[model samples]
Target: MKANPKAKADPKADAAAAPAGSKKKLMIAALAAVLLLGGGGGAAWFFMQGGDAAAEDTPKASKKKKKASNVKPHYVPVEAFTVNLQPENGEQYLQVQFTLQVDGPEQATLIKDNMAIVRNRVLLLLSGKKASEISTVEGKQQLAAEIQAIVQEPFAKGGDEQDVTDVLFTSFIIQ
Candidate 1:
C-alpha cells in the first residue's frame, strides 16, 4: 500500500514550540550583554577613579608629615652676643647683639671656630652701610638675612652636617 500524499499537519503544536525556543534564545542573549557591559564599566571605573585618588592621597599624607617634621627642634641653648662694627665715613658707631640658634654640634663647632672671621665680615658689612640701612624694619630684616648667610656659608662649605636655624638681633644700639 502507498502512503497518502498529504498528511494531516498539527499547526498549533509546531507554532507553540517555535515561539518558545526563540523566546529562550532572546533571553540568554540579553543576559550576556548585560553581564559584559557591567563588567567592563566596573573595570574602567576601578582604574580611572582609584589611580588618581591613590596618587593624590600619598603626597598629602607625606606633606602633613613633613610639616610635623619641621616643627621639631634640632638645637637648644642658642648663642647670643654683641659685635661692634668698625666706624666708617664719619658715621656714628653701630652695635648689634645677635641671638643665633643652630641645629647640631658640628655647626656649633664651625661657628665657634669661625666666630672672629664672621664677626669681622659682619662688621665690614655694617660699616659699609649708610645709617639709613639700619633705620627701617625692612632694612634690619635684610641685615639679619645677610648676617645669617655670612655666618652659615662658611660652616656649610666646611662640611658641617647641619644648618643654622636663625640669627636674631637680641639688641641693637646705633650711636
Candidate 2:
C-alpha cells in the first residue's frame, strides 16, 4: 500500500516482461521471414517454366487440332442404278447401289446439293462398262475406285476437290 518511489520495480517482473517482449518480436520476425521465402519460391517456380507463351498455349492448341481431326465422317447415299452393260457374249444388265463416304459434312452437303450431276456422271460410267469388267471382286474394286474418282472431281471449275473416301456397294446384281 506504500509507494516505492525511490526503488526500481521487482527483478522477477522485469525478467518476465523482457521475455514477453522478445517473444512478440521473435514471432513477428519468423512470420516475416516465412512470407518472404514463400513468395520468392512461388515467383521462381513461375519463371522456371521457360516463360514461353507458346509453351503455355501448346496443350490447348493440340487439343483443338485433335478435335479438328476427330470430325465424324459423313456418308452420301446414292440411289440404285440399273444400266445395260456392253454385251460381251450376250445381253447383260448391271444393277448397283452404293453410298459415298466423304471426309466431312460439307462435302456430303455439296454432293447432296448437286446429286443430279453425280447421278449423271455415275450412270454414264456404268453404262459404258462391260458386264465382264465388273463381274469379279477385283473388277468390283476397280469400279469402286473409278466411281470414287468421278465423285471426287470438283463440281465447278477451280473449286476444291471433293473428299470422296470410299464407294461402299450395297447391291450389285448382274442379270
Candidate 3:
C-alpha cells in the first residue's frame, strides 16, 4: 500500500516538472526576442543619424553648400531680326529672335545702352548667311557662336569686350 502511494506522488511530480520546464523555455525565448529587437532598432537609429563622427569627417553636408554656386547669370532680350539671306538656288529670307546671356547686370546694361550698334552688328552678320547654312541644327549652332563673337566684340576700338556669353534662340525661320 505504501509503494502504491509513492508511485502516485512520483507521477504528479513529473507532470508539474514538465510544465515548469516548458514555462522556463518560453520565458527565455521571449527575453531573447525582445533584446534582439531592441538592439536592431538602436543600430538603425545610430546609422540613420550619420553615425556621429563619420558625418564631419566625410563632409557630406558641406558638399551641398559647394554645389550651390554663388555666380548668378544675367540676360538681355533682343528684338527679332528679318533679313534677306545670301542667294542659294533661289532668294530666301531669315527671321530670328534670341536673348543674350551675360556675365552680369552691368554687361546687360551696356548692351542695352548701345542697342543701335548691337542691332547693326547682328543684322549685318545675318544678312551674310545663306538659307541652307542657317537651316540645319549644326548651322544654327554655328550661327549662335558667330553671333556671340560679334556681340562680344568691343563696342569701340580699345574698349572692353561686351561680355556676351551665350545666344539663346527663341524663334528661328529660314524661308
Instruction: Note the Cα lDDT for every prediction shown.
Output: 0.67, 0.89, 0.86
What candidate 1 gets wrong by more than 4 Å, as runs, is 1-90, 155-162
Considering only N, C-alpha and C atoms within 3 Å, which residue pairs clash in candidate 2?
A: none
Candidate 1 residue pairs in backbone clash: none
TM-score of 3: 0.61
The residue-by-residue lDDT of candidate 2 on 30-118, one tens digit each, is 99999999999988887785445575457656653444456777989999999999989898999899999987798899999999989
Per lDDT, the best of the predicted structures is: 2
| TM-score of each model, paired residue for residue | 0.49, 0.61, 0.61
**Residues 81-158, candidate 3, lDDT per residue (tens digit)?**
999999978889898999999877788899999989999999999999898888999999999999999999999899
For each candidate, how many residue pairs have backbone atoms clashing (under 3 Å)?
A: 0, 0, 0
Better of 2 and 3 by lDDT: 2
